[model samples]
Target chain A: MSTSTSTSLTAPTASRVAGTAVLLGLTLAPFLLGPYAVATLSRILVFALLALSVNLLTGLTGLPTLGQSAYFGVGAYTAAVVAKNLTDIGPLQLLIAAGVSALVAVPTGWLAVRARGVVFLMLTLAIGEIVYSAAVNWKPVTGGTDGISGVPPVVPLPGTPALELDGLVYFYVLAVFLLLLGAVTRLGSTPFVLALRGIRDNEPRMKAIGYPTRRYALTVYCGAAALAGAAGSLWVSVQRFVSPGDAGFEIAALALLAVVIGGTGSMWGACAAAALIWLTRDYLGNLEAVAGRGPLLLGLLFVIAVYTLPRGLAGVRLPHQPSRKRTA
Target chain B: MAGWLDGNLVSVVDGIAFGLLLFTIAVGLSLVFGMMDVLNLAHGTLYLAGAYTAYALSDGTVPGLLLALAAGALVGALGGAALTLLTQPLARRGHLDQAVLTLGITFIVADLLAAAFGGEVLPTDPPASLRGTVDLLGHTYPVYRLVFIAVAAALALLVHLVFERSSLGALVRATVADRDMVRAQGVDIRKVLYGVFAFGAALAAVGGVLGAPILGPGPGVDESVLVLSLVVVVVGGLGSVRGALAGALLIGQVQTLGVALLPQYAPFLLFGTMLLVLVVRPHGLVPSAVRT
Candidate 1:
């Protein structure tokens, strides 16, 4: 519809400028914001990564997934268990987490990618619920929903001091997030992504053109799961606690909502929407005027966003393609 | 093994009751999913609303239970109509949009119910007359569940007859074939869509009302039921009443008996079962349409 068209109309220069400014804000956040605000920002960055993962499949590849949180949970628990027994190095934990998540994604994503549209959604959702149930019932490994905690603080590097301050931890999360974000952005111009968009627009046509659409879908599915798993690792570093709720339906739904509100396929849009949602949940919901009404406000936000921002906030940005098309 | 079967017969029978309850909820979801392609995530909210209705109305009497069922049906119908109205326009965009919109509705309604009923999971008791146990093959089982199995069996038969053999099935097929032609006949299409909603939502709500004693009304029941029913719908295949029945009964056994037998690996068992069924028959056990 209008969404796909408006998505193509975003001014690249304007997007770069906004992206730079946002990066600056994130880089300087520790010095500017309070400890609590910094912690929230850190969480937002992790959630934004999750939103990016959803953007990869749901937004980019046209496979509606409600199963990314399962990988997220897996990454977190893997990291927790790694920190407990394997290694306390943050990067190592992240690698192991992402690896584990991608491994889990193999069979689950295999089953999921067989169907498209709502059936795909159903399969992924059941996958998420299954993972969530496993997290709760697998007492020996997952800690039986209480999750793993009281681990040694993650050392960002091999020889560095273990991070204890929230500000310092925020920097570590920011670094990995930036790395992944850069990689995904670099992936945008590749022909593989072009194939993904093709699949999204019309799978039958893509298949008729001799493109292996299913493989494309499955590849993106694993990549997205890895990205979500990395986010989960960051989440562990930020909160130092993990729980079954991390892999629950709500997280998957919110991540998918972030992708939708961000304008499907718009990376920065998904990240921005994720931040906005988290702020609404953490700040606006807890504000004295609307305390304990977070879910209500979130619900209202969802309804309004779907109706008012059909093309999403990204689509609204620099909408006038005629004047903004000037090259640098 | 004989001793084990003898000991666990209650759990097996319990699975049937639980499965029937799942059928009531999943049948509506499956039909709407197959026909409309609308991702009604708030379908569980309707069930929650019905369970809450049961909790509010049940005075430990049969009349109260009946009243709760009727009221639950009304509440569910209204919710369904509202959801249909909210989501209808978004369907053209994509299922993702519908998913977001319906999820929003779910969040708003679930929070409202939570605020009204408190955050705790409230236990809803069966009517006084149905409270006692009944003897079955030298084993005692809840009278309400035994009655529920009978009622649900009858209900399932009725749904089968109504959708499969009745003229309504022809009308549905006709409408799906040509919308404008049906509209030309002076049937308000919105009302028909609303009727679809009412049928599906009413069934789910009634399931909630009757199932309140078994599943209870709680903060997270909506989500669990939603997931469970989604499992049933997928396992049974969409738009087929028989599919929903088969899937629900199978899942009911997996859930109850699996828990009773291997408490630790119950979730894996559910996954394994789903994976096995899907691997064998990707369209589910009884897909209504052999779609490409």
Candidate 2:
């Protein structure tokens, strides 16, 4: 809703140039950075995709869900299973993962979209926990807590060599990330997204205006699930291992947090915030001085961010969009 | 048939105890959410803090248990007051913001608790006098569990009577219904809010102190307890004590009996029951007459 006010009809030339510069930097980063850094960047991109999926529901559709991890886990497990039993074609794995995730989302999203606000949040939380429990209990399929390991390297194309090298994997992840990112950007201008925003702002009004609000909500929910699942599949390709922990509450919470910290409704903001959060937990946590204090520091970050960054990182400043109006 | 009854009797009793414990915890959460429109995600942290208090202060004596209860209640009250301060500013921002803020608090408090108590599940014992077993339905059950059932049942009854029967309860209800009108009549509505928040939090902490022996203190215990309480609150109707009791008892039975009967499908059973209930009663089983 606030985004609609700032992003008026005319395209802001400055922001476009800035966005291009950022994309150029990202494209060249793998070559400039070390293998470890490239791998981290690749992981960040995967998490960013997951965060973007969360933004679709929370930011765009006004559905605050803590269940994206369910689809993410589903995608990861599906990919792992596919890699172990079938061919390791990356695109094929991603497609299956997204399809299965979307299929699973239909019923769950139907139930979830029926409720509004806190009730909806509770339902999603329950669904997430249930999925996590399934991951832990379905030992034969998910390998229980140990998860499915020894996943074969991903082949970008059917005839191509497997991408075993970290840099090559990063490239594969980057390519998929960019494709999905562009697709999502294109989707933002569609009538469907406008309908979703209308639903978010006022469901009753949208319904009165002849919009099938629930159908739109469910559609976005499934789309978001598919995106999260795609991210999960990419996660398996990058890590070469899938565990129950990958689909746990922490992942769901962090993804939601990243979306909030990035400023709701801004896709690029969500991606950047996801990277910051991932680095805070993964890179900063591994530092010798802060070793084992990751959760403490992360908790502090959450507190400070919620208090300080009310509108999130995206709300900071872009020549195009003005700062959010402070209501209180 | 006699053998089957005997086999299920223990689980049935365990279900009652578990259900009562849930009632103690969830009633507070239900009341706070219903009355104040604040989704306190850190409610479980109060329970965790109370359990930790029991672990720290219990000396295996009756007095020790009482002390733990008092301390737990005090800690909960203080924590509740602090939460009130934190959430009051964001009252106008909507429940989502409140949820996020409280979730942050949950994270901070849980991390602090883990730092202090370590990550291991600390199993606590009941007071020495209540340690032994008692014969029930031709089977032996722990004396502490039976005592817990009795105490929790009494507590539930007290809460029901206080909230449903007393003038103070009337005042609280009136405040929830029309805070501006209540304030217009010279009632210090802020005090009422603070009192409700503190009392509800205290109840959760007391539940934690009593339930520590059953659930134990652990790293992820806060999360599990939070989920269970949320389920109970949702199933029982958000603001009503009777609803909380009914929801907790049903979930308790489903948890204990379902696990005992169908160990492999226990997880699905919990969510299945929730799904079934939500489908039938979208507003919960016994929605409050006064809608928020």
Candidate with maximal TM-score:
2
The best candidate in terms of DockQ: 1
- Give per-model TM-scores: 0.92, 0.94
Q: Which ranges of candidate 2 are over 4 A from the true structure?
A: A1-11, A318-328, B1-3, B288-292
* lDDT (Cα, tens digit) per residue for candidate 1, span B109-174: 888988899999999999999999988888988899999899888888888887779898756645
Q: How would you encode candidate 2's per-residue C-alpha lDDT over A196-260 as one tens digit per residue?
A: 88887778899999999989999999999999999999999999999989998889989988888
- The ten-residue window of minimal lDDT in model 2 chain A covers A319-328
Query: What is each predicted model's overall lDDT from 0 to 1?
Result: 0.85, 0.88
Fnat of all models, as shown: 0.58, 0.35
Highest-lDDT candidate: 2
